[model samples]
Target: MTVTERRATTRAAPGPRPAQPPRAVAVGVPRLLYVLALAGLALLTLPVLALLVRADWPGVPAAITSPEALSALGLSLRTALAATALCLLLGVPLAVVLARTPTRAADVVRALVTLPLVLPPTVGGIALLYLLGRRGLVGEQLDLLFGIRIPFTTTAVVIAQAFVALPFLVIALEGALRSAGDRYEVVAATLGAGRWTVLRRITLPLAAPGLVSGTVLCFARALGEFGATALFAGNSAGVTRTMPLAIYTAFNGAGVTQDSAVALSLLLVVVAVVILVLARAWKPGGRG
Candidate 1:
């Protein structure tokens, strides 16, 4: 019963297993993705770098100081800011509706609101013309009744930019709204707070970061807008012309220095970078 049986039992017990190394193929997908992502980043970044490299540093000051350039920049900033304001005014409510509503119409409306994001800016410009031109559908009525023709003006520039950029604000705000927990609202209501009071005091504060990021993104996009503004507003210097339009004009003309365009492009790149950095630094209560 003795030594032989004990030895056999002891031998039958499991021994320490050797550790296995991770498979090379197991890590391949993520490595491939990393490489591809880096490649994409390089491709996107190179053009901006090239623009900066091509820019004449000395001429940049002169070019930007020129009346044409200054006017374009000023107009671009004004119109872009106006467009961002319009987006905030309209997009926040749309986002709340999309986030809270259960109806099928809400889905459709949300989709419609995002349509501009996918649509070509040129096509959007043309659509705006059809809707608001002197002979356009309701535009004719406005022309006759109020003597208002919206095309080829600063207002037209703002409208076009807003149409293109509104989707960004809507998407951002919708994401924030959905991510935000309703527990605060419930607590506020239990404390005798009204819907508007809760929204103003609680919801908006919680969603501030997303709102700020979206506004920055919308403004950046509006600032860089070329196709819609050019087409709808007509690229007239000191009137409808913006920074992007000015860049295009400079690129097209023999007398115009290419460095001027490069400098302007660099300016946009810097602005985008600053906005992105600020967005990354921002934290809102609802992120959790």
Candidate 2:
């Protein structure tokens, strides 16, 4: 090496060593927390396990396939689907309003919309009755104008289910909308897109995942609806008798046996499980 080069190399200090990244911490959960978690899990799971164990596995197929059971299942599916549709129709607009608007009145409206989630289902049924029963204010006007009956009917069942399930759809969609923010929507507006176009093309597409999840939750809640349905629609055979109602009937009614109730309960559980699994597996249209 040249003397000048050697002198320069010796004069310069070595570059600072590259900084090492910090190591991740290893967390140790307390034993008490583990015990409590296990206890809570057991509390939630043991009853379902007991029901499964109590069910007459050999008789389940025959019991659930009987004419009465089949009718109830069919009615439940129809009403639940109808209710889910209703929730989607009404909930999307409501969620949009709630997510976009920032006002006290909007907060009150949101609370009112979700009130049924905390209210007892039976109270909801009574409220429905007061609002739509034959003697009700709206019902009386409807009957006077069109001779329409509201209570103790298939329509009533759908309304009851929708009433109870609407909150789930609204909450989910609102959260999704809030998380998605208004960036794309603002850009669309700047580009001269109309409100409806922005909603249809950008907002709805972005929130599709939440919409699917909310729809599934609403459908499941509707499928298991009982107290509101019973009080508002009545548990008539092949009519308002949904699976939950049928299970209740079979357990208490003189015509059906407890074994049938157990079978129907198992069927409902299986259906719920399948829906949850499908919801988890579902991928939104635009998600990566």
Candidate 3:
């Protein structure tokens, strides 16, 4: 080797080495924290366990199959399904917009979109009523032009459910989109793919895990909607009443017994548990 190359290699070898990060220190969890966490868990779960303890297990079938119960269950399922469909239709596009927009504008839009999540159900119901009631802003115009009434109808049930559930899908899908980054989209665009093609092929596929979990959450939330549905749609048996409304009615001694309410409540609890299990399965690194 030449003398110059030898000298350069020797100089480089004696240069300062790069710094290494310190190792993580293992910290022990406090016993108090553990105790508090256990308490919190119990606080959330005890009510459900108590409900099971009191439920009329043998009478569940009879209560669930009663004509009114059947009508409420059917209505709940149908409306929840419709609400979920509506969520997927509008929420996907809104999520994409939130994902791609500038930070400031996105924050504003996201806040507005997620408002209903924190808003009380009764407040939401009241707001919906004012906006869509026969004498309301847009409702009055509709009444004059098309003679269409919105509140206290089966359609109001769907609207209330969708209003509350939309944020679940939007928040989930947006998180997925942000995590996925824009690398693939940039490549697709450079390859001459249009925005629609890129979204259809790359964005949605990458966000599939979030989409599945979001859809499940949306459906579950819609299924359990009560205050909004009660206020906006009323408690019409064949048209508007859902399982939660039925349970509320029975609990208040309108016509059905407390046993029937407990049974229907158990059914809802079961549906919630199944949905949570399904959601866990669709998480990014989950079993499914």
Candidate 4:
């Protein structure tokens, strides 16, 4: 063999050529979707932005500190928190049942649990009134036996909020329970753990993320509840009136302009955003 040929044969083959960068795909559809998403985001953000813009800085502190406003805020916070607690207490079990059960009734139960999500808040108020208002179904018995009427009171506010928010918690916890495989529960059973022990030790811990997320979402929804709260509870300072009711009052009150209403709305928005941020930050790996 020639020396040059021999030398070339001895040399290692050249490494594979570096891969070419991927080419951009057609732009029309993607660009359109991006623009649409941005538009939707902007639309969602516009009301909050307008509220902030129209706020009267000098008037805000006074408005917020006013007795009526303070009372409504307090009531709102108290009722919302109570409702959230109730939702967590009841929703977690219902979610577990929905996730674990395989009976034909399970589907029906799940649908019933989620019915409040689609039911109009005003309709929920009416339903609650029918069931619990003075002279209504259970209300008459409660009043006759215990002297307790449920409607047009703080309890009504809580019930209304819970009615609306429970569905959120149920859906979230159900998804979490479903996503968390049954292997851990099986392992716990094999290890001689009881059903409740397995749930408490293995299932609950694994579903913590979903449970926390659902609780936060439920709290947020309860905080902003308006229609059912207003319809069933009625506006009563330090009793049933909440922030949203106060906003309505301010909007409708003579000599109170839309700017004032906007300012109050901005305050609600800020509180909601802070809650969401905290909820996200509290998660182990940040919110998904």
* Clash statistics: count for each candidate: 0, 0, 0, 0
Worst ten in a row by lDDT for model 1:
279-288
Cα displacement (angstroms), candidate 2, residue 80, comes to 0.5
lDDT of 2 at 52: 93
| TM-score of each predicted structure versus truth | 0.86, 0.91, 0.87, 0.88
Error of 3 at 97 (Å): 0.5
Instruction: Name the runs in model 2 displaced over 4 angstroms.
Output: 1-19, 253-256, 286-288
lDDT of 4 by residue, 1-288 (tens): 999998887786676899999999965667789889999999998867777777888888777777877787788889999999999889999999999997889999989988988999999989988888887899889999999988888999999999999999999988998999799899889989999899898898888889988999999999999999888999887889899988998899655555566667877888899999988878644544
What are the clashing pairs of model 4? none
The segments of candidate 3 whose C-alpha lies over 4 angstroms from its true place after superposition are 1-26, 254-256, 282-287
What TM value does model 1 have? 0.86
Candidate 1 lDDT, tens digit per residue, 1-288?
799999999999999999999777743466788889999999998887787777788788888778888898899989999999999999899888888886999989988998988888899988989989998897889999999989999999999999999989988887887788688988999999999999899988888877887888899899989888888899998889999999899888764477777777777677778877877776665352
Arrange candidates, best TM-score first.
2, 4, 3, 1
Per-candidate Cα lDDT values, in order, are: 0.86, 0.93, 0.92, 0.87
Q: In model 4, which runs have C-alpha deviations exceeding 4 angstroms?
A: 1-29, 285-288
* Better by lDDT, candidate 4 or 2: 2
Candidate 2, residues 1-288, lDDT tens digits: the string is 999999899889698799999999999999999999999999999989999998888888899899998999999999999999999999999999999999999999999998999999999999999888888879878888999998999999999999999999999999999999999999999999999999999999898888889999999999999999999999899878999999998999543389889889989999999999989988976433
Better of 1 and 3 by TM-score: 3
